[model samples]
Target: MRRSERSMRPRRAGPVGRGDRGYVTAEAAVVIPTLVALAGLLVWGLMAAAAQIRCVDAARAGARAAARSESGADVVRVTRAAAPEGAEVRVTRGGGLVRVRVTVARPRFPVTLTAEAAALDEATVGGGGR
Candidate 1:
């Protein structure tokens, strides 16, 4: 081949230069992972909040039921039904009142949330010292 023909041959581009003129791919690589992590965190937070609310509601329901002369086992059943998945429920009744405690455990996260509730005696609900 002639010297001019060799010179006319195109030279290969470098990594810094060529069609990739901007940081589009690099920027996307950083931004996408960050956005994905943020989304995961947001979903986890929402799940935790929902679990907390369910735990509280479960405790309140169990307390109310037990206060109305329902059995402790029944209270536990009701609490479990109302509570979020993987929740532990404890019910105690004495002195014409009932108390319920709920503990929720998150499977994906290392966290536990607790809620406690009490229901007043029927006498208190009706009137004091009838």
Candidate 2:
């Protein structure tokens, strides 16, 4: 080959390293599952928060019913209707105050949420007539 011809030809790039091959694929393999796990955690967190809000709502509903002098069965029924599925409700009255507590268990996570509400009982608001 002539010297001028060889000089005019393009120089070849350096050989690629073994480690560099499929680097992007390896990175993606790790990153994709991590991203999916993060998304799942976010969804679980949202669900847990929603369950907590439902517990709060249920407690409030039960407290209101108890304060209004509703029967015990009615108070429980209203609270359960307002609560999230598989929740527990408890109502108690003491010192003119009606307290309602609601608890819910998370489906995927090993977590529980509890909420309490209190209201003045109507019967205790006024003294019996003389």
Candidate 3:
């Protein structure tokens, strides 16, 4: 065999160290679960934010209904309709003002969202001057 022929042949790679044999597999085993959990958390966070917005809208709707002197049942119905699932509504009236609060809780996740709003009673809108 010519020296040039031996040099031209492709060299085989050296054997991997025992420690490095399953390193990539171990990393993937750990990293995949971590990544999936992170993605789940992100999705849950987005859902919580959306629920918070719904709470705010529900509160506002209830307040408007109360301000217009709608029946208590009607105000509650409106608020609940606008709120996220498993929501609670509270209405308070005083000093010619109506206040509404909405609270929401998710069954799968341990979190609570709430919002409150107030509006002047329509009947109290005007009354001034001698």
Candidate 4:
């Protein structure tokens, strides 16, 4: 073949580079799982926040009932009804004040959430001093 003709002919294709082959598929495989894990973490965080809100509400309800001179059993019942599932309620009275605490366990996380509220006991405020 003449030198000019050889130069005019097309060059043979070379083997694909390692950097280009299957790159998109590899990236997608990594990214998809990472995105799924992030979504799961976000959902778990939202659930934990909701549980914390429930605990706060339940503590407030129990504290209000206790301040109004409701019986201990009734206060606990009301708090538990307002609280999230698997939550614990505790009421304590000290020096004309009623304090209520609610604790809830997180299903996906290892941490526990706690909320507390306090109110002045109405009975003590209106009663005559000894």
Estimate TM-scores for all models.
0.73, 0.82, 0.80, 0.82
What's the lDDT for all of these models?
A: 0.83, 0.90, 0.89, 0.90
* Poorly placed runs, candidate 4 (over 4 Å): 1-19, 106-108, 127-130
Candidate 3 Cα lDDT to native: 0.89
- lDDT, model 1: 0.83
Q: Which model, 2 or 4, shows the larger TM-score?
A: 2
lDDT of 2 at 122: 87
Best by lDDT: 4
Of 2 and 3, the candidate ranking higher by lDDT: 2
Candidate order, TM-score descending: 2, 4, 3, 1
Residue 14's lDDT in candidate 4: 77
| Model 2 lDDT tens row, 1-130 | 9999999999977786865899899999999999999999999889888888988999999999999999999999999999988888889999999999998765634787999999999887767323
What 10-residue stretch in candidate 4 is worst by lDDT?
103-112
By lDDT, rank the candidates, best first.
Answer: 4, 2, 3, 1
Candidate 3 pairs with clashing backbones: none
Candidate 1 residues lying further than 4 Å off, grouped into runs, are 1-22, 94-96, 106-108, 123-130
Count of residue pairs whose backbone atoms collide, per candidate: 0, 0, 0, 0
Q: Candidate 2: global Cα-lDDT?
A: 0.90
